[model samples]
Target chain A: MAERTPTQTPATVASPDPAAPPPRRRRRMKDLRKQPGFDTMAWFCLFCLYAPIAVLVVFSFNDNRSVVRWTEFSLRWYRAAFENDGIRHATWISLQVAFVAMVFATTFATMAALATTRVRAFKGQTLTYAVINQPLMVPEIVTAVSTLAFFVLIKQVTGLNGIGFLMLAHTVFCIPFAYMPIRARLEDMNLTLEQAAADLYGTPFQVFRTVTLPLMAPGIVAGAMLAFVVSLDDVIITLLVGGPGETTLPVYIFGQIRRGITPEINAVSTVLLGLSALLVSIFFLIGNKRK
Target chain B: MATQTEIRDPGTPQAAAAQDVMIHAEGVIKTFGEGAGKITALDNVTVDIRKNEFFTLLGPSGCGKTTLLRLIAGFELPDRGQILLDGQEIGHLPPYKRPVNTVFQSYALFPHMSVARNIGFGLEMQGRPKAEIKTATEEMLALVQMEHLANRQTDQLSGGQQQRVALARALAPRPKVLLLDEPLSALDLKLRKEMQIELKRLQGETGITFVFVTHDQEEALTMSDRIAVMQAGCILQVGTPKEIYNNPARRFVADFIGDINILEGELQQDGGAVLLPGGASIGALLPEGAARSGKVSIAIRPENMGLTAPDAADASLTGEVTNIVYFGAGHNVHVALDGGGEVLVRRAQTDAQVGAKVGLAVPDAVQVLVD
Candidate 1:
């Protein structure tokens, strides 16, 4: 008893002190804690994500080239941003790329999503699924390298410096991104509405045109917006494949940053930020309205 | 099977029933799949639903009654036979093209549309005038007593209300025949009974041939002018509710139609009497050559018999009382008869008490159906 007294006492004191109260408290608090929880880990992750972006937005308005210390507020850099021909040209190119890429991506995404979900079983199902999901599974660097190799091979064989290749590559990368949402929407849609339409004497084509397409509009729009945003902000795939005349906004932003940290870039960043946020908010509003 | 349908049903409109072949099926066979794996859902089935009659397909689940309804509705094509509606071969007609509308088991109300839109859906699709659709939709909704709630969403309404809307929608089309698939099963008990009466009334007021399907025996007895009891994808018996309940042709039909005691026995047929395996004889008289002296079974309804003390001189059988149940209208007594047989006897509340010793006296003519 005397020899074991000290060790037993220390074990009881330390073990209970560390975990017993916590275990009991954790068990008791579950009901209350579960009701209004936002998942602390998730909230913390989002805080980590947006806090730096907030700092970037705040610093973009910083008055001086060296933004660490706030000097004075000024619009000089913002004015300079508007006048920069390279930024303007890059912005126009980004808009054009985004428009072209999204149109191609959304159309192909809708067709692909419908085809995948409609055909019950086929020999190429596995192969087709794998090919479509390849961009998600493979490393971005591997895709960039392979795409560059493929583009160079195409040019060597055809003797055409095709600018459309970059847009196609960006579109290819965005298909799965666009397709995930549309396919999920299509798969989750109830088939009874369409059946009711058919029973009411509407032909299959009429049912699809009137009922199915309208119900799926939100998904299509959301997917197209996602593709547009992805194409606008693309850097790795664009850098690997884009020609000298077709520099997108992100690449232009990158080249500017490499040369120097200027206030003009900050103004351009602010405009791009506003545009993307507006697009996402609009996407969410329309998406939730239908479902 | 010989058709025992009364050629001149008092309820049938004269003009409609005058058309001999109002709706008939000739060996209609509908198989689900192909080859060896196929399920013969309907097998050489034939029945005629005389116009303006509430003809019910009565059966347990998987009995192919609803399949028969779907075939008539043109929702399904028979594998090897033809179905004629109003003496026309509608064998290949689609549901929309055929002048028949189905009230599906689930009601199949479009979740996205309102009650008014759903009721007017068929009219709208037919490209009818907007005013006509609105008037007809309102009139049909009013007929079902659901006009006040026409603007409410389909998903927002109660099950019974939704069923009413479905009825309204199907009725608005004014098809030649209205096909209902267990429509009342989706409602509560009270609502189901109420809707059954309402449905019969609707059939009367509309004067449309309602070919309905139901598994509930009491419901079929109450509503159907004629019923077809199906088992294992074939029609076993078709008769009026009274005929099916009282004069069921086979032991199975009698047992299934209502609560009846199936007494399997040996027959000792004499000139006017028939003795049983349990040595109890029934029927004071039988027509000559009615049955041979051999094995037979009789279906005895619980309500047709009474009990006397077990020691009485004219006792049907000596027995001890086992249990007594209080049915609201009567008391049902379970007695262990002599020689280890159990019999259920129903009586008015004043007729018998629990544990009372009694002999049974089944009526001389309680419709003794032998098989």
Candidate 2:
């Protein structure tokens, strides 16, 4: 300790009582930030992940008509995107589909989560969990193809081709996303509280309404927001299952990108990104508040 | 405690049973799991809990005390026999339908609600009017001395405060019986002692039957009016605290309840005394229906025996003092017996040092254990 102190001491001040050996001998510690190339690698990863989104957001305010060129700042693309009838129609369709699917998905997810968690373990519990999460495990392209085939079979039989099929497909695909948060909340809840409620003369239904629902409300809201985001971002299933008049925002954006890139599309994409960010932030706030 | 007895059915046995008993479990057998892994949590356990009494089911962990309490609370059904509440078979009823409430071991306070809301929950669930619920909640808050913190969230309270809230919530609906599942186990030692007195006071004030389950023998003795000592999914004995401590019916009870010295002996021909291995005879108090002749085991509490001079007349056995442990109130002297085995004698003060020869005096209250 005595030999190491002189080498470790800083030269900022004259050594005070050399025999005492400085008050604290500094130790060399392994710091990730100080490692060579660590900060650069981290910044490069972030830039790769977010630079395109940043460019799109910055260029959305450009007044020039050329998509690649930037002029003085303006909100013309945002205005144009809002004023265009096709964008409005597609956005309305997207909102309607996401709202309906979110409600159905969240409701079913809550029930499934409760059924699997609140009750005593039974036969096929693992199988039930696996089936609930099957959509999340299976590739989206496969789900879209199978759903399209099934919907085509239904249309051939009953002549039923409507936006309901798109909503149904989205709900089925979003159930797992909605289930994850609600299940986590239910598992974290104290089982004794429900038992206490029941002991206090609350019937099963009354207990759910008075105690369980109020306690798990944050998880339900979080799950609903997640399901809404998932449904709104869906492209493959929406494109395959949507009827002729049921063009959603993502499908419309895909069609626009195929034809050509435009500032209006950038504006629309930026708005979608902003909506998703807002909903995700709300989800995180609810989850943290529960803690 | 005066019971208002109705003369309408004076001769009926059922009425007589209902007048005194709050809950009675007969031949209850509850098993968990299936096949080889199954465990019998309650093995034909029979018990009677009287009205307005602090009845405790005392045992170590996994001894079926909590299972019995759960059966009374309608959380679990018996595989065989019945549980009657005031002469009504309630084993089939759900917890909500039973006129009983429970203070869970965890307290299980609702995190989303305030203290007042938690206390008033039972009353509100009963469909009582808003004014009545508020009045009852206030009364409960006052009962638990928590009126000042009634508006605070349950999570803000300390352990003891949460316990008080749990007790108040269970009592709010004025249930016929209140079940507490080791509610004081979560508190510190000092707080636990305080809650013991508080629980007994609340039981007396409310005049409601309390069936408390706990593994702590001291807590059971301090708070229970009567305790059922359970082991291996069966109740070994049931009696008042003094009766259980003085005359434990089984060897397990004597060892489990407190510090007891179990000595092997042979009963004399007259059956009035037991002869210890060291050629000394001590008087024995055999329980009712005990065997008259054979090898026997006896239990004597440490406090009942004492260290005497080696040649004293009352000395039952002579031994050497091996170790002395000092407690705040007294000291426990360990004496290695002359022939075999060891005994501990508790004394307020002792002059005999280590390696000193001492005589162990047997107590008059010798409980001959029935294995």
Candidate 3:
């Protein structure tokens, strides 16, 4: 690219020189055209990435039952989704599960981040960090199976079957997702502020409350959002751990897709996508405000 | 200055008679990490910081100066030792319980808080009344000349402004002793110089004992009433600036404090002079150990030596001028002797060239270091 820029400059500079040969001038013009050409591969890659999402979004308002056939633009699927009993119940369950998982996962992850990043070296610190990040490294199916087996054992010991178990599974799976951002923030924080707080007559707990916690607020919010999104979108863990009446929105969508493709699923998915995008924007705004 | 002389010899009867001992650290040892990777940050260090004195701990990086400061502030507990503040052993107490505050090197101003809030944070932590905190915060802001920036966020302020805010915040609570860990190091040269004097003035006005740590020897000399020169976790010497510079107790102290040309020689039989290997006998204060060993190093400050004609009668040694370094105010004439040693004589702008033969005249009060 740099070589081309130099070559093109000489061509324009020699444009008014009649002494220059016509063939060479024509070749230079061709070269100039070629140098300013568009990157086809980049456009192809972008299209490949966004085309499916575009199709999903456009087809979400399809008037026909078949998602592939768009007879006319209509809001029937959205209205139908809102009025459906099973979808509504599953959406409510998903909201409850996501809220619970987000709160617990964010709290536990923030503690883990502080313990690993703020505290100095201790016995088994590396092992503890690795254990906290275990779910992120393992396959989601493996986590689903292990959590299913663990919940089965718990149920055998004490008869429990409800959204509570599903919420616990989602929280366990979302911990690593939440841990990443919170730990990164803690590591990036300047430690001298906390030391200064302590030196300024703040107790250990007071230092955390006044300095560390306020500074780590953005990371906590981001981590909570990430955990909420992960729990809301989870299918395998919910399917494996949930019993009857505990089917979340994603699981219901999967069941509907397995039965048949419907515009209602697309409409529900678009809404979820919009919700996640809104959350991500909020995260970025908070991050920028802090900066 | 009189009190400085009285506390100069901390181990002597004069220092024991003085009633201004604010903090006394005895056999303080701190180690980091464990096993093979362990580092002894402070090794059996003992020192006494006097009341209302601008005492500085001067050393290079990793010299345990910062560790000592942190130990005094109760940020880090000593592995084994006692730290007594106001005659009470408070080594095991947490930082909040101690009557001390620290101005960290990075300023460490709370980025989220305004300058006023940052200054008031300490008083708030102490559970002071809201009205009292506001008054004290405003007073501290005025002390640091930062009242105009009272409501501004700390992150919006310049480096010097943030530094003032940090100082104001630390001083608002009126700590008995204040620990400053290279607070001026982050500022530019001019700002650092201004703050050095400002800090001394503040210390004088408040009558708070300041334990400042810095690697810059000039800053230590200019601002401190007395300095503890540390190296490798040990305090080599503790004395006033004039005493530390003019009568360094050890070779490291003499070399670390300022530029000096060390001349290796043997102590004379009378124990009042050193016989140089370059056929020159110079008067020196011989230590008892050097008297027994007959070996010593004569540390002559470059400014203390003079350059003269090669065959001058008062010249103690003769050498060829090897190099000349100009410092605008003066020139350092590097002289090489026939006996394979070099000495730098500081001179004003002179006609002496690099290859000119010159005679070096040493003053009578050269420091004689045994180690």
Q: Give the interface RMSD of candidate 2.
A: 15.2
* Candidate 1 per-residue lDDT over residues B165-242, each given as its tens digit: 888888887878888999988666777888899999999999999999999999999999888888767776677888
The TM-score ranking, best first, is 2, 3, 1
Best model per TM-score: 2
Better of 2 and 3 by DockQ: 2
Name the top lDDT candidate.
2
CA lDDT, every prediction?
Answer: 0.77, 0.88, 0.85
Off by over 4 Å in 1: A1-43, A73-78, A115-134, A141-164, A285-291, B1-23, B26-40, B71-80, B250-257, B267-274, B283-294, B309-318, B351-353, B363-371
lDDT of 2 at B57: 93
Deviation of model 2 at B286, angstroms = 2.7
lDDT of 2 by residue, B145-170 (tens): 98878888876666777888999999
Compared with the true structure, model 1 gives a TM-score of 0.81
Query: lDDT tens digits, residues B1-371, model 3?
Result: 00111125445564453367999988888999889999999888888889989999999999999999989888799999999998989898988999999999889999989889999999999999999999999899899987777888775666777888888888999998999999987776777888999999999999999999999999999999999988888887788998788777678888998788888877775667778776677677643234434677888888888888878876778899999999999998888986788888887766888899888788875668856
Stretches off by above 4 angstroms in model 2 are A1-38, B1-18
What 10-residue stretch in candidate 2 chain A is worst by lDDT?
A1-10
lDDT of 3 at A141: 90
**Where's the lowest-lDDT run of ten residues in candidate 2 chain B?**
B1-10
